[model samples]
Target: DAGVTQSPTHLIKTRGQQVTLRCSPISGHKSVSWYQQVLGQGPQFIFQYYEKEERGRGNFPDRFSARQFPNYSSELNVNALLLGDSALYLCASSPLGGTRTGELFFGEGSRLTVL
Candidate 1:
């Protein structure tokens, strides 16, 4: 089976423009989480969704949002983007109900650049 995958591989946008990133989970998984990885920094959790319901959220601005579909695919939407928002958006997936280790598999991520 294939692992998690994300689209656009790279993205470039001017400040104030919005962007939408997409993700497909690994086979047979249900939980999806979104994270932001700034240069030289670890990814910070943005949101987590399971069964189309919001499971968890991190300390991010309201401009950051996401949702998981019934089929487990997910999309992350960022509004009123800023230069500070430029970062790698990673999508991760794990089995249903999650594991004690939170062993989530990650995608290469969509790299966003704001000018």
Candidate 2:
């Protein structure tokens, strides 16, 4: 089975440019979540979508948004990207959500660089 894959492994953008990152989850999975990893910090949850519905959201600004598709893939879109938004956008997957101790399978991530 194919593991999660993300596009544009590295991206460079100006402070105001918008950016879109893509992710394809492992086969036979349905839940997709997004995390932002800043330098020297643990991944912070951004959003979690299950069965194409928004299950949970994190402490992210409106500029951060994401969606999951019927094929279990996902995309994260950030508008008005700021210099502080420069981080590793990680896409993770789980069979389902609401697990007390579930682990996430992460993609290599789309590294965003802002100038």
Candidate 3:
């Protein structure tokens, strides 16, 4: 029973670049969520998906997108990176369909540094 896992634990990029972060949920979990955590702030919800269909999204701009695979793994892609986009991108998996479930298992996160 592994916990959620995310790749490229940390990375650096310049403005205008694009980045993709990957995640794998804990075994048997069907829901995955993406969150952005800025320094001194709690994680902000970005996207949620269940069974490979998008179920929810936050107030982020069109630059942010995500998709969940048939196996329940997910990817978060940020286009035209801005300095404001630099943050710890967290991936959480739950047994239920949404974040309200309070049953989330989170990965350590992929830290992005935009310059």
Candidate 4:
């Protein structure tokens, strides 16, 4: 059972470009998934797509969207990227959601660079 995994560890994109980041949850723990953006301060809650449906969203604009696959994998897609969008995008997996019981496991994250 591997920990959460993310693809394209690093990427470079220009403003207005579209970017897609992928994530896979641990072998058998996928009740919910979370996407977070990390700048300097810390990880900011971006969105939580549960069981293939959007459960919660952050302050991000409509350009930010995501989806969860049947296999428990997920992808975060951002359209019309902005310089401010450059950050470490993190993915977390949990056996249950809305508990906030410190049961979440996170991945190393994909580093996106907007130029």
Candidate 4 lDDT over 1-115, as tens digits, reads 7899999899999999999999998887664454556575678777786678777787888998889999979999999999988899999888775535347799999999999
Clashing pairs in 4: none
Backbone clashes in each candidate structure, one number apiece?
0, 0, 0, 0
Candidate topping lDDT = 3
Q: What TM-score does prediction 4 earn?
A: 0.90
lDDT by residue (tens digit), candidate 3, 1-115:
7889999899999999999999999999999999999999999999999999999999999999999988999999999999999899999999897547567889999999999
Question: Compared with the true structure, what per-residue lDDT tens digits does model 2 show for residues 1-115?
Answer: 7899999899899989999999998887788899999999999999998888888899999998888888878999999989999999999998866734267899999999999
Per-candidate TM-score against the hidden true structure: 0.95, 0.95, 0.96, 0.90
What are the runs in model 3 whose C-alpha is more than 4 Å off? none
* Candidate 2 Cα outliers beyond 4 Å, as residue runs: 99-101
Off by over 4 Å in 4: 98-102
The reply for model 1, stretches above 4 Å from the true place, is 98-101
> What TM-score should be assigned to candidate 2?
0.95
Please give the distance, in angstroms, between residue 96's alpha carbon in candidate 1 and its true position after superposition. Answer: 3.6
| Ten-residue region with minimum lDDT total, candidate 1 | 94-103
Candidate 3 has an lDDT of: 0.94
TM-score of 1: 0.95
* Model 1: per-residue Cα lDDT over 1-115, one tens digit each: 8999999899999989999999999988889999999999999999888888888899999998888888999999999999999999999998965434278899999999999
The whole-model lDDT of each prediction reads 0.91, 0.89, 0.94, 0.82
